[model samples]
Target: MRKIFFSGAVLTASLLLGACSSTDSPAPAPSARASHNAADATFAQQMIPHHQQALEMAKMVPSRSSNPKVVDLASRIDRAQDPEIRQMQGWLSAWGVAATSHSMPGGHEMSGDHSMTGMMSDADMKSLDAAKGPEFDRAWLEMMIKHHQGAVEMAKTELAQGADAGAKALAQRIIDAQQAEIAEMQGLLKQG
Candidate 1:
């Protein structure tokens, strides 16, 4: 009788311990994967402005050049990045965050070169605007390579510290794909 009672207590304790462990598992990891909290909300917000700026640069290519290569490259950039903007917007909606708020993103005003990658400054935009023929193509390639490099850096930062898996996955993809594009742009510049 004593042996059976002792064994029953042990079995009950084991079941209770198992239940406690399973409940705790749901809290930390699942919170990290889907949906938004502060980290994911901030990521999409900051990334929207960043992506919008890149789109502007990509859109400028066709009118600025007659070079088929430059035109093709510009089109590719536009096609790739425009959807990112929309996707990020969707993320913001799903996360219950406002895409545009009265305040600036990541808690600061996002002006100047340091805030974004491959972002064309006022003078850079002017230069591209005025450039024509081979000059236009060369300038576009050089500037875009620098731009893509900037994006690669930003993506790396997101992968390191970002919380949401979806956002992290997208960032990793950008880093891989943009690095390849940067290499291609470098090759084109060298050939020029």
Candidate 2:
């Protein structure tokens, strides 16, 4: 029961945080929320780079991992994030904000850590790229758990502070999805 509740907490955290990040783009002005609240802007700016690193990390797994679980999770991460990146780009353009930096992760007091809270460091990525077989699978799972948690934290901030309806909704979705992924990653960790 305690585990169930903890999982619920993670879920709630994800709903609050995940729905907040937008690697896609800024909200377009013509879309009613043009004059986005400061929170919304911050969410987009921070999320773009946050998602980018996840993509970078996800791409590394296929070649490095031989395990089906690692491959499946990496594929899901890429599939989910690719469209989000495009969506965020569109939002930024419409909002009249320059999506600007593609080089770093989200960095607001909201998203906090740009590297998604140390989920994927330069060394982590480099190590994953170097690893093969089961070793790659283990490293990938460990890094992804942290990355997903970072997303949850950022989403919680958005749910708490963001005024834009769309941003809030997305933040909720992120909380749901990523928390589930965290569970999956944990299971993999136990197996390893």
- Return the top candidate by TM-score: 2
Report the C-alpha displacement of residue 145, candidate 2, in angstroms.
0.5
Residue 27, candidate 1: C-alpha displacement in angstroms: 7.9
lDDT (0 to 1) per candidate: 0.74, 0.76
Clashes of each: 1, 22
Flag regions of model 1 displaced more than 4 Å.
Answer: 1-34, 37-39, 100-114
lDDT of 2 by residue, 76-174 (tens): 989998787787667667677767543434332223223445446565677778988888788788888888888888888989998778778878988
lDDT (10s digit) by residue, model 1, range 103-177: 544443364445455566767877887888779888888888887787777778777777778888888888887
Q: What's the TM-score of every candidate structure?
A: 0.73, 0.74
Cα deviation of 132, candidate 1, in Å: 1.5
Candidate 1 whole-model C-alpha lDDT, 0 to 1: 0.74
Q: Give the poorly placed runs of model 2, Cα more than 4 Å off.
A: 1-35, 101-119
* Local lDDT at 60 for model 1: 79
